[model samples]
Target: MTAAHCTFFGESNPETVQSMQGCMRKLKLMVPKLRVQKRVKELEFIQHVIEYIRDLELILSEDESYTPHSTQISPISPHLDSTYRP
Candidate 1:
């Protein structure tokens, strides 16, 4: 059997480039055999991991004692409250 070869056009060593090309060829040939359901599950797991990382980042960035100015309003006057009464 004739040996297969691939050419690389960069500063890479010939042996390393040849091995990488061979592995890429094998991966291309095998990709069509991968299941769609398995791919979806893998993507879902990746998405969940990304979301968990974002949530943790938000939690870590927040101050435990931080309070919003909106929640610090003074009590409304009783006369102002009666104006909107049904």
Candidate 2:
């Protein structure tokens, strides 16, 4: 039996970078569900994904040489409040 592991490569290609940036921009446009705070699990999941995407954006922005698409890295807008208790 053989074990498998997943690996992630930092994409430096101009076209792929542009596509990823576009997808991230589109993700930011998503609207939260009505009364999302009521759903604790869903809210937590959303927060986790948002944090991950922000981390990815930070990595992309740090590579100044790969900016064939756009040099501007806009922060994702906050759709949910940080201090919400269920």
lDDT of 2 at 75: 65
Candidate that scores best on TM-score: 2
Expressed as tens digits, the lDDT of each residue in 13-81 for candidate 1 is 868676765754543333322212243354554454455445444543574754454476554334332
TM-score of 1: 0.28
Q: Pick the candidate with the highest lDDT.
A: 2
List runs of model 2 lying over 4 Å from the truth.
1-40, 68-86
Q: List lDDT for all candidates, in order.
A: 0.44, 0.48
The positional error of residue 30 in candidate 2, measured at the CA in angstroms, is: 17
Q: Residue by residue across 1-86, what tens digits does model 2's lDDT show?
A: 11111111586777766665555344434424323333346456467557655655665577687575876876644623342222
lDDT of 2: 0.48
Clashing pairs in 1: none
Report lDDT (Cα) of residue 60, candidate 2.
55
What would the TM-scores of all predictions be? 0.28, 0.33
